[model samples]
Target chain A: MSRLQTRFAELKEQNRAALVTFVTGGDPNYDASLAILKGLPAAGADVIELGMPFTDPMADGPAIQLANIRALDNGQDLAKTLQMVRAFREGEQVTPLVLMGYFNPIHKYGVERFIAEAVASGVDGLIVVDLPPEHNVDLCDPAQAAGLDFIRLTTPTTDDKRLPKVLNGSSGFVYYVSVAGVTGAGAATLDHVEQAVTRLRRHTDLPLCIGFGIRTPEHAATIARLAEGVVVGSALIDQIANATSDAQAIDGVLSLCSALAEGVRGARA
Target chain B: MPANRAHGALLPSFHSPVENAMTSLRTGPDANGLFGSFGGQYVAETLMPLIHDLAAEYEKAKLDPEFEKELAYFQRDFVGRPSPLYFAERLTEMCGGAKIYFKREELNHTGAHKINNCIGQVLLAKRMGKKRIIAETGAGMHGVATATVAARFGMECVIYMGSTDIHRQNANVLRMKLMGATVIPVVAGTGTLKDAMNEALRDWVTNVDNTFYMIGTVAGPHPYPAMVRDFQAVIGKETRDQMLAQEGRLPDSLIACIGGGSNAIGLFHPFLDDKQIKIIGVEAAGHGIETGKHAASLNGGVPGVLHGNRTFLLQSDDGQIIDAHSISAGLDYPGIGPEHAWLHEVGRVEYTSVTDTEALEAFHICCRQEGIIPALETAHALAEVFKRAPNLPKDHLMVINLSGRGDKDMQTIVHHMEQQEQHA
Candidate 1:
């Protein structure tokens, strides 16, 4: 099994949802971002999503958009992002790490080179927001063939007709974008998320992760009861955006990850 | 598939025996929504089902006579279709090499070819039972056009314009507001066309239930590029009929400025199968290509995906999209439409660039010679006319898509004139 599958299986055995913590790679600066990544597993994060920053992150909201700009301004490129992954992997294992972002940076980095380096750099999965199943041959098929799990984001807008197509080649956990809006938009109702989870359960057996509009531990706890994993991106990245220094950025993200994890761990208690 | 040509040259004249032997360039973007490897539905999965529904609806509307009748009604009576293809007597005399004709898209309602697409999209929105209309604009022509159609159709309209563009194009902002559109200024990413487009996409993703995103140009995912091209093709169709009636033959060449390439594609698509007419798309070179400050994607860019399609984009080596600069807000986009990228790659269209300086000169000349104030975006195409017209044979007829009027561009032009006077 892939690292993602292994992690989720362990989480299932524990009867708790995985706390999927996300932060942009090299945000604010390289050292601080690497510090946050290295501390995530210790901070109780079950899965880590490192954002590969691109200038035009159209799918992101203000919080994550600012995160991408900060990462890029601090001279973070694909090469540095991969290097950060390698460094994080030197100290960390078992916790599945997924690189999430748009497709252009990967395209420019050369897809083959990106997949090869990602696999070698201890990257386990990808969550490309702009790459729908329609163009799966471009990246998804190739990456999956190379043993890298290709996660698909199934939104509220994806009806029953489209759900199977989205889940067909999907590995890792299936991401349920709880809202029809961009990242960091208003949270969906628990009722809406519940219905979506039930519908997604009918489609595929892949573990389902819920993201978008998830912020505080209370919200994470609420979603943890319904899905296999809970994703919090902008909420954690906001910690970096609000930090006075690199040390605070690392502390802010790790501490929040611990708190969110605590909420997810005790949700079923 | 047509046999690939070595250069950006047409196959042959339409009557040639080779014409039937080869495939048509018009048939493109196979089932996967690709024009070669350029165009595709690269949007988020949230928008995919909607895009597919739109494509299906568009295909149905293309076949339905009722839809055709309604579209024709709006085109003829509302948006003023069949904008004249007038022979530019002064421009032809000034060039002293070719007979130049102006495809006067500026005379359409809302004063640009943008209304052509807006009318078609608004009608589609109504057909889809959408209650709200949203769009992204750069110079505000498209915003104003979208606003106008939305008001006419009695729908709630919202337009996203870049903060920088809103400041530069204040007149268009007011015009959009006067038409009842809520003009939201996007303050992200240098606050330009691409940023506004990003915001608009966000809006569409959020309001996918009852909203229609009437894209202003021939860009975006799948059906958008092809649909916008079909709506704008009225320009080429009219020019074909007008030129044949007036000059007794098809024009030898066609030229238009390309930002997202709506106007250019509209004018070029009908002629793509002609196989003899030369097609040229002029991109805005804000400074120059060498300075790395231009928006000439084909000239100074590589193939990459953005705004839901893979196209030629001005991006850094790290794949960060470099901000594109142009005096004309309409042309200040880092990427070209995916179809244009395909055309450039397949050698069906020659793409070039016109610096801000050259476009300004052409703007002045067109105003002085034709007594017509041309949009700064249109001026880029005019600049190319000045370059190529003077070298072609006297009987070599040329059609330039006068894509918009200069009314919204007066501020930019005045600012440039002031700068020139100060430097002098």
Candidate 2:
């Protein structure tokens, strides 16, 4: 089994939920983004979702959108984002890294070449927010061939009838959007998250990572009690955006990561 | 909430599988969702149920005799379908290569062929009891068409356009606004056609129950390509009858510019069986093919899924859709319709690229010679005629689908001309 699968299995055994933190690669600078990524695991992050910036990000909320704008302003493209991941991978190999972004930049980069590059860069999986499961055949086949997981997202609005098709095809943990709206919009209601997770569990045995509108340690803790993982994206990126310097940004993300991780751990204990 | 719950259950099966599956499969998107390895329903989980519902509904509706009767009535009364096929006698003689006929979609009520598809879709939406109609546009042709139909049907209309497009295509935007339609500017994603589509998808996702996304072209998921093509077949149906009467024979060549490729498909569908007649689809090569600035799908694109269906798309190595550029805003799209992709792959149609300069030259040539100023989108097809005319014998006939008039593009063309003179 791959390291992500192994890590997920271990987390399940320990009755602990994984903490996934999202940050835009090259948001401020490549080196700074690398530093932040390298620091995340030690700061209590179990998985790092490195965002590949694009000109258009339709599914992203304000925080991640602004973060992407900042990244683009700094001249971050596909090659640069992959290079940053490679840089982070040099020092840290254990923490599973998921490359997250819209599909345009990747499509511009040839699919086969991207899968090869992603595998070479030690990317464990991908979460193309806009790439629906129906269109994921191109990415999923190559990813599976490369021994990399093609993570799929299941939302509350996903019809129960079609849930099995999405869940069965997906590998790694299923990234379940807790709410119907875009990322960073509102808090995921506990009942809604539970219902979605329960519905998904009926379809697949894959770990479920609940995300979108996840803010505060309490929210993380509450989600941890029900799901296999809790992804803190817009909240962490918002923290990074407010920080003054690279060191300050890393510090802010680390603290938030620690608190969220501790909250999840506390729930497990 | 209770009503919505009931609607949800009814909606899922609204497009009955048994009825739609056969016809839907006959189109580009196969049952497995491969449109010659291009079109598939690549959408979010939240939208799947709705897309499935729409697909099923489209299938059932297509077979429903009442739906067909209603669509036929609207096509005749509203869109003025069976639009004439005028022999461009003056221009044909001036060119002196082949007989040329123009499929007079320009004579349609809205002065474009877009209303044909809009009338059909709006009628379907009304039958489905949808309250609001939302659409996206680049050159505002589709928006104007959608707004016109919505007004006739007395439905709330909302059109999303790129802010950049709104500024550049101000007259069409104003026309839409004046027609009791809310024209919302989409400021994201380079502020262009793709952005407008994204915004429309978002609106549909948020307000799916109350809204009907009147996709402007033959692109999008399964039912749309087939539905739009069915609506547009009127173009071909008229041309076929007109050709038999006027030319005494089938035309040797048929040409149309491809944006989302609805107009081209409309004209191309009826003739797909006639293998002798050459069907040429001209794509926009913005600067030139070599400069990496173009929307020439067959030349520069790979088979991939975007929006909702598989088609030829301009994308990078990683499968992210690249923004396409063309002087004609209508043709500024990253991908073409799934059927076009299938047709190109199957060699049923011939695809070529037309540069901005060539299309503009043709635009001016037609304006000066024929006294007909065609939209830049149509100019792409006109460029093909210029290229093909020299190769063909004098006896050969070429019929071009003059999909729209140039009224919507006057300001853009004038501004472009001023810029060119300034540079010179």
Candidate 3:
């Protein structure tokens, strides 16, 4: 089984929600980002989402957009990002790591080579924002053949007719974008998410992880109870944004990650 | 299957030998929205449903006689349709090669071909019960057109423009405001046309309901390229009729500047199967292609996905869209229309570039010789005309689509004029 399957199975047995943490591959610089990646599992991240920095992140809001700018300004690229993942794998084995970003860079990097290198470098899954089910034959089919999970996003606007096409070749987990707005904007309402999750449950057996607006630990904990997993991204990147130096960025991100870890862990207990 | 939508699906990929070429080649985009592997709706999923809805509405409206009649009335009374086709005697003599004619789209009310598309789209927006109309513009021509239509129909209007465009084309910006539009200035990613488009799309996703995004150019998801082309084909249709009446024959060639390629495609689509009439498209080369600061996508760019379509664009190695430079604000965008990308590939039209200096010379020459000051965007096409005309025989008739007037270009022209004075 893939690492995502194994990790999700373990989380199922544990009878608690998974805490998925997201950060850019190299937010401020290489060494500090690597240090944070190595420590994410211990800080309570069941799945680590490493963002491949892109220039035109149209779907993302202001905070994560700034994080992408910071990573690129620090000279991050696909090679260095893969190196960071490979280095993180050296110390840990069980936790799943997914790479997320737009599709153009992968298209520019050459798709077959990117999938091969991503698999070799220990990437367990992918979530390309702009690619839809109609165009899934471009990357999803190939990545699945390479034994990597391809996560698909469902929005609040996804009706019954469109949900099946979205869930057709999806694996690992289904991401429920709780808001119609861009990433990192604000939290989603509980009633809307509850109804959405119930509707999605009738369609697929895959684990549903809700993202897009969950920022604080309390918000994450509340969202954790409603779904199989909760994703925290912009709020953690906000830690890096407020830091004075690379050291502070690394410490600030992990420290907040630990606090969010506690919030999600304590929810069921 | 609906009439227009289903017919669009059944279109043949290319022209057949026996078919009258005057009938358009709508075989493009297929069901997957691929115009011979160039155009597709590659936008964020948030906007997908809205785009599909608009396309369906447009399809229905295309077949509705009432909608066609309403649009025709608007075009005739509001936009001044059938803008004159005039012989340019001085220009033809000066070029010394081909007999020159001008489509005179500049004489249209509000002074460009942009109002033609806006009137068609806004009428559809009303039929679909959309209360708000939003658009993005680089030169502010399309913005003013959208605002004018919105005021006419009593719908709320908003326009997104880049900060640099707002500064240079302030006259049109004020004109848009006077027509009851809220002008939002975008200050992201080089603060130009591409940036303004990005900001407008951002607003669209956030306010999906009650809002209709009227893309100014031919480059977008399917139906837009085909729909906009159909609306503007009035230029080519009038030219055909006028030439038949006046000169007793079709012109040998046609020329138009391409910024997202609306005006050029508008003039070229009706004549696609003519087989003998030559077609040319001129792109702005801001500094020069070699200097790496031009908006000449066919000359200097590669195929990539941007602004909801896979088209030719100026981009970095990592697929990040690079800022395009042009003396004309309207042409300072990274990508050309997807249909233009396919047309370039098929060699149906010859694509070339005119440097900023070359277009400036043509602008002055048009003023001195023809007593007409063309927009810097149109000046690029005039420059190409001057180059090719001098080499052809004098009897070879060539018609150019003078896409817009020069009133909005005064700031850029004045700045260049003062710089020349300082240098002298």
Candidate 4:
């Protein structure tokens, strides 16, 4: 079985939803970002999505945008993001890692080289926010050949007809956008998320992780009841943005992740 | 985990819906948004709701006879469509090469050709019972058009413009304000056209229910590119008949400046089947092609998706859109319309770039020789005539699309000239 499928199977057996944590790589500083990534699995994060900063991130809300700005200001590039991922992988094992961002940097790096470098760095999946399933055919085959899952996002707008296409190409848990707009724009609606997740269940057997607008423990718990995993992005980045030191930032993220995990566990029970 | 099962099972099912939709739309030349492998609806999942909604609405709107009649009335009465094809006798003689004719879109009511699409969109908004109209503008021509239509229809108008543009094109800002449209100055991300679009999309998402987004160009997702093209088809319709009557035949070449490519597409659509009529599109090379400052989409851009559609865009290695610099505020956009990308790929239209200096030269040449001050955006097209005129025999005739007048650009030009004088 693939790493994603194996991970999902284990989670299913345990009757537990996965805890997905997102952090902007090189945010605050590169060393701090590396330390946080190394510590995440121990702090109850089952999956880690390291965000590569871009100049104009249309899908990101204020919190993550600010985090990305900080990262870019500190000189984070594709090489730097990859190096950080490599360093994190050296000391840690078993925790699945995904690189999530826009497609320009990857396109610039050359798709084949990017996939090779990502696979070498122990990246299990990728979620390019701007790459839709229709356009992903070019990247998907190469990524799959490299044994990396090309993760896809299904939003409220992703109809029943389009869901199968998204899921078919996607390997790692499908990211269900909880809102129609950018990340952290509003509160997660359980009713809408439930409808999306229920609809998605008919199309794919892969784990479904609800994200975008997922803020509090209550929000995570509500979504976790229906979803196989819950990914928190803008809220965690917001906390990290306000932290004075790397340790303080990691501590805050760990607490948030733990609380969210507990909520998911409670809902599962 | 095998490829055989995945591709085999999925290919058959996927082809059906896409094929059905393509057939319903009667997509010509390009196969299902192929556009010779350039145009497609490549957008994020979040934008699907808006894209689908617009596509469904546009499909129904296109077939509705009442919608067609309302659009026609607005085109005839509001925009004064079938705009004159005036012979630039003095300018043609001065050029000393081809006989030039100007498709005087500048004479359109409220100024510029922007109202052609604005009138159609506003009428559609009214039919949909939309209470508010929101738009993004760079040159303020589109903002003025949208605001004018909104005022006529008694609907609220909100226009987002770049903070830099508001200062550079202050006259247009003032005009929009006087027209009772709230002109929101966007402060983020290079403070230009792309930023204005970003702000507009945010506003649209926030007010999706009661608002109609009056996109200024033949860009954006599925329905927008096709919808705007259909509305602007009046330009080509007028040019075709007017040219036949005046010149006794179709002009040898048709040229238009491409911003988001609305004006170029407007002129190019009717002549698509002519095969013999040479089509040319001029892109803004702000300083020079080598100077790394321009909005020449096809010449200095790669394929990418933005604003809900796949097209040629000036983007970084990471896919973030770069800030486009041009003398003309209207042409300062990173991405071109998807159809232009298709045209470039298929070799249907010969795409080229004009430097800021070359455009300014053309601007002054037209003013001195023809006694007409063309918009900087249109000057790009005029500049191309100079380039082609030197190579062609004197008998060759070229029709240049005089998209808009230079009134809105006076303040910007004055400021630019002052900066140049200070440097010198």
Candidate 5:
């Protein structure tokens, strides 16, 4: 089994949802971002998503957009992002790490070379926001072939008719974008999410991770009860955005991760 | 002849739905909305089903006689279609080599070729039962055009423009407001066209239920490039008939400016299968292509995906999109349309560049000699005309797409004149 499968299976055994934490690689600077990445698993994060910053992150809201800009302004690039992943792997290996961003950088990096480097660097999965199943031949199939899990984001708009197609080649887990909007937008109603979760359960057996507009321990706890995993991205990036010093940025992210992970751990109690 | 008055108007060929044969180079985006690997439905999964629905609706609307009839009615009565193909007599005489004709898209309802796409999209929005329309604009010409069509169809309109563009294009801002559109100024990423598009996409994703994102250019995801091209192809269709009627044959060459390449594609698509006819697309070289301060994507950039499709983009070695610079806001985008990319790759259209200085000179010449104040974007094409027309044979007929009027560009032109006077 892949690292994602292993981690999720472990989580299922524990009868609790995984707390997936995301942060842009090299945000504010390389050392600070690396510190946050290394501290995540120890701080109770079950899965980590490292953002490969690009200039244009179309689907991101204000918080993540600023995060991308901060990361890029500090000289973050694809090679450096992979190096960050490798650095994180040197200290730890059990927590499944996924690299997420737009597709242009990977296209420029050469898909085959990126997959090879990612696999070699211990990166476990990918969550490209702009790549739907229609262009799966471009990256998903190839990445999965190389042992990197290709995670698909199924949104409110991914109707029942299209859910099968979206989940067909999907591995690792399915990210349920609770809203039809961009990242960091308002959260979906619990009723809406409950219905969507039930509807999606009919489509595939893959673990479903709910993301978008998820912040605070209570909200994550609420979602944790209904899904296999809970994703927190913008709220944590907002901590980095609001931090005045590098140390404060690292501390802010890890503390929040601990609190959210505590909420997910005690949700079923 | 009155320059703005279109004469010898005939029913445009688009009124009839003709199934394009497979052999024609005009047929593209086979089912999947790809222009030979350049265009595809690369948006998020949230938009895939909607895009598929749009593609299906567009296909049905094309074959339905009622859609065609209504589109033709508005084209004639509302958009004032069949914009004249005017002979640029003094420009031809000055060139002293080729006969030059202007496909007067500038005289269209919103004073640019943008309305041609806006009309068709607004109609589609209405058919889709959408109550609101959203679009992104650079120089605000497209905003005004979209606003006009939304008002005509009685729908709520919102336009996303860069804050920098809003400051430069205050006149067009007022025009959009007058038409009841809410112009939202985007302040991200140098506050330019690409930034505005990002904001618009966010808006579309959020309001997908009742909102129709009417992309202004030929650049976005699948079906958009092909659909916008079909609507704007009236220019090329009219040019073909007008050229044959006036000059007894098709023009030997065609020239047009390209921002997202709607007007250029509109003028070039019908003539794509005409093997003998030459086509040239001019991109804006802000300072110059060498200065790394230009929007000449094909000449100064590489192939990458941005704004929902794979195309030639001005991006860094790290694949981060480099901000494009052009005096004309419309041409300041970092990427070209996917069809233009495919055409450039296949060697079907010769893509070139014009410096800001060269375009300004052409703008002034067209104003003085032809009494036509061409948009800075259109002047890029006129500049290319001045370069190639003088060297061709006397009987070598050339048609340049006058894509827009310069009424909205007086402020930028005045600023340039002031700087020149200070230097003097």
Candidate 6:
């Protein structure tokens, strides 16, 4: 079994949701960004989604967009991001690392080479936001063939007819976007999220991870009770945005992740 | 994929609604909304349903006679149809070679070719029961045009423009506001057309229920490239008839400037099957293509995805979109339409570029000699015309789509001339 599966199984046994913490690779700079990433597991991030910054982050709100700009301005590219993943793997091997961003970087990097390098770097999954199932032959199938999970997103507008098709080729956990708007723009109601999770459950046995607009520990806890995982991206990046210095940026993100992890840990109890 | 086609539609479609599986690579944007391996619905899942609806509606509307009738009525009376195929006698004599004709799209409503597509899209928006219209503009001509159509149709209008464009084309910004559009300044990613498009897409995704995104160029997701091309094909259709009427034969060559490639594709699509006709698309070389600052996507770019479609883009090796630099705001985008990418790959239409210096000279030449104050965007075509026209035989007929007027470009022109004077 993959590290992701093993971790999810262990979490299922623990009867608590997984805290999926997201941080852009090389935000501010590489060393500081890597430090924050390496410290994620201890701070309670079960699954780390290291953001691959692209020039145009269309689906993202202001906070994540700025995070992308910060990362890019600091001279971060796909190569350095892989290096960060490789560095993260030096100590922790069990925690699954997912690279999340738009597909152009990976497409430009050459999909075959990217998937191989990512697997070699101890990366477990991919959440290429812009690549849909229709264009799966481009990235998803190739990534999966090279032993990486190509996670698919199920948004609020993903009607019943499109659900099965979206889930068919999808591996790993399904990312349930709680709102129809851009990421970090609109918060999803617990009632809406609960219903969405239930609907998605009928389609696939893949662990449903809800994200988009779950900002606080309360928001995390409320959602943690309903899904197998809780994704906190923009809120965590907001920490990096609010910090005065690089060290404070890492400090701010880790502290917030620790709190959110605690909230997820307490959800079942 | 064939099951996805809209059934029993009336008028002929731009494409025959091919299967999405891409069984054959002969034509483009198959049922899956792909142009060979280029275009697709590379958007958030929240937008899939909406994009599908748009594709279906556009498919149906293309077949419906009422839609065509209304569009023609607007073209003839409101926007001004068949904008004169003027014989540029001085330009031809100056060229000392080809018999040159200008397909004067500069005479269209709003003083540019932008109104051609906006009218079609606004009517579709009305048909879709959409209460709001949103558009992105680089030159601000599209904003003024969209605002004009929205006012005509009684729909609420919002236009997203880059901060750079907003400052440079302040007159058009005021024109949009005067036409009742709320212009939102987008300050991201080089603060240009591509960024403005990103902002507009964000707005559409957020307000998908009530809004119809009126993309100014022949770019974006599936139906948009095909739909906008179909709307703007009026330029080519009229040119074909006008050429047949005047010269009794198709022109030896046709040229139009490209940004996201609407005007070029508009002129090129109708002539795709014409064996004798040669089509050329001119891109903005900015300072020059060698400087890595131009908007010549095919000339100086690689294939990548941006703003929801796979196309040739001026991006880094890491797939980061490189900011495009151009004196002409309309051609300042970093990417071209997906179909242009496909057509370029297949070697049908030739893609070339003109520098700011060359375009400025062409702009002045057209104004002084032809008495036509062409837009900076249009001047790119004129630059190419000036180059090739001098070498060809006088009997060799050529038509250039003057896609817009230069009234909105005085500031850019004045600014450039001043900079040149200082250097001299």
Lowest lDDT sum, 10 consecutive residues, model 5 chain B, at B1-10
lDDT (Cα, tens digit) per residue for candidate 4, span B36-66? 5555565666665566676678779889998
* Candidate 5: segments with Cα more than 4 A from true spot: B1-22
Error of 6 at A54 (Å): 0.4
Cα displacement (angstroms), candidate 5, residue B35, comes to: 1.5
In candidate 2 chain A, what residue range of length 10 has the lowest lDDT sum? Answer: A129-138
> Which parts of model 4 are misplaced by more than 4 Å?
A159-168, A194-204, A244-255, A258-269, B1-31, B127-129, B317-320, B390-392, B420-424
Clashes of 4: 5
Q: On residues B4-51, what C-alpha lDDT tens digit does candidate 6 reach at each position? A: 133224112234335322333234567988887888889877788889
Candidate 6 is scored at a TM of 0.95
Q: Give the TM-score of candidate 2.
A: 0.89
Q: Candidate 1: misplaced stretches above 4 Å?
A: B1-22
Best by TM-score: 1
Q: For residues A1-269, what per-residue lDDT tens digits would candidate 1 score against the true structure?
A: 88999999998999999999889998989999999999999999999999999988888899989999998998999999999999999988888999999999999999999999999999999999999988899999999999999999999999998888899999998999999998998999999999999999999899999999999999999999999999999999999999999899899998999999999999998
Candidate 2 lDDT for residue B20: 47
Candidate with more favorable, higher TM-score: 1 or 3: 1
Error of 6 at B86 (Å): 1.0
DockQ for candidate 1: 0.92
lDDT of predicted model 1: 0.92
Each candidate's TM vs. the true structure? Answer: 0.98, 0.89, 0.95, 0.89, 0.97, 0.95
Q: Is candidate 1 or candidate 2 better by lDDT?
A: 1
Better of 4 and 5 by TM-score: 5
In model 4 chain B, the worst 10-residue window by lDDT is B1-10
The residue-by-residue lDDT of candidate 6 on A1-269, one tens digit each, is 98889989999999999999888999978988999999999999999999999989888889888999999999999999999999999999899999999988988999889989999999999998888887889889888988898889998889889999899888879999888888888888888998898899889999989998888898899999999999999898999999999899999999999999999999889
Clashes of 5: 0
* Candidate No. with top DockQ: 1
The pairs that clash in candidate 4 are A104-B317, A104-B318, A104-B319, A105-B317, A105-B318
Superposition error at B230 for model 2 (Å): 2.5
Q: Report residue A173 deviation for candidate 2 (angstroms).
A: 2.0
Clashing pairs in 5: none
What is candidate 5's lDDT per residue for A1-269, written digit by digit as tens?
88899999999999999999989998978999999999999999999999999998989999999999999999999999999999999989799999999999999999999999999999999999889999999999999999999999999999888998999999999999999999999999999999999999999888999999999999999999999999999999999999999999999999999999999999998
